[model samples]
Target: MNETKAATASTPGTHAHTGMTTRHDTWWLAPLLVATGFTLFIVYATFRAFENNYYEIGSIISPFYSPKIDLPGWPFSPAILILWMPAGFRATCYYYRKAYYRAYFLTPPACGVSVWGSKSYTGERAFPFVLQNLHRYFFYLAVLVLTILWYDVFKSMLEPSFHFDLVTLIMTVNCVLLSGYTFGCHAYRHLAGGGLNCFSTNESTKQRFKVWEFVTKLNEHHMAWAWFSLFSVGFTDFYIRQVCAGVFPNPVFF
Candidate 1:
């Protein structure tokens, strides 16, 4: 053990004995921005979930409140009943795990940086971290929620007579962006056909291969989809709140 320590200590590219890279570039900037953006989103989402009142305006219910459910005798926000599905899905997302692990936990911080636990480190094999495996289950739940959200968006355009408005456009874009993100999930890509050993096993397998290919295309841009969808959903909620508060004008073109 002493000899191994001596060798590690002798390594010159990283700081002595600490294993951290001695990069002179702005490597810290990425983590700083990621942490800041995540913090802002969390704070905004929490406030909106608890506030709950301005989430519904006519057929244009905010993404935060679609398929609205409030338990009997429940005193808190209805969003409590709805937010968990998407929130859990995002929290356990494969890409997001990398983001938070680096930014929040400083576990490597960036691609080449050495983490505090680089030695004897086990990735997601421990207690709390093991819960990340539930990402697949969360994907299932999020799909159900996304279905409801799509319905809500169409309802907004059709209900109380057909009309197109700024709110409708915003909600539509939010749902589309979210669909791209959710369908591009690593769990979803695997579910699409990752288990199959051959794509030409039969007619059914051939069709499944097509789905897998489509999902693969989306997965190529999963990171972009993830960020865009997040912004869209948050903006949808904010715009709805503004309309509810009479602070923003939502013009309709019928």
Candidate 2:
């Protein structure tokens, strides 16, 4: 028994003494993929936001420019006004925080892998990390933004003449994916019923529990929805931009 205890205690320290690392294969690949995908998205989004034009065509508005607020004498992109809220929301997303921290910061790039930061790690309690507490507030603002996006989707369907075009279909699908991403938010699930002490104590609480369960299921695949929505929104903007630029005519089906 004494030998077993001594061996167990010494095993963990052996890695540090010998400079040994994780045993997992391909540990670096996931973070590399995440970094590549996120970097491309940031570059593309920055370019589109600055371009400003081709954001609207007929009734189809780019997701980047939905609920467009024209600020008189404002020098920067109009997309700034609408984009900031969602941008903040996504930046503070729980899943995204884990992703960027791993991919960009190399904070234990993968499970079983060695962490790459300083020995002193103060997570989510210092300087910038403390700001993540604002995610819930961002969630509220995102709900409003999502409402406007859905309105855009409906408006796209109600063009003067009844016709379905590639842009229209893309915008509609974008809304759906965005909805999945937004509604599946961990903050939203908590808001639904996470604070309740007992679900059976009250009818209202029980009802909220049901809603919470549904949101929980959605939250399980939040990562998938997050990536899908990101690509879908960017593609929606690109499609609208291309069509508006006359690079390609919108194929319509009535």
- Each candidate's number of clashing pairs is 0, 0
lDDT of each: 0.85, 0.83
Error of 1 at 207 (Å): 0.8
The numbered model that scores best in lDDT is 1
TM-score of 2: 0.90
Model 1 is weakest, by summed lDDT over 10 consecutive residues, at 10-19
Candidate 1: where is the Cα deviation over 4 Å?
Answer: 1-19, 117-120
Alpha-carbon lDDT of model 1: 0.85
Model 1 lDDT per residue over 44-115, tens place: 999999986887888789888878886899999989888988999999999999888878977667655566
The Cα error of candidate 1 at residue 69, in Å, is 0.7
lDDT of 2 by residue, 81-161 (tens): 889999999999999999998899766565545455335567789988999999999999999999998888778778776
Total colliding residue pairs, candidate 2: 0
Q: Which regions in candidate 2 have their CA more than 4 angstroms from the true location?
A: 1-20
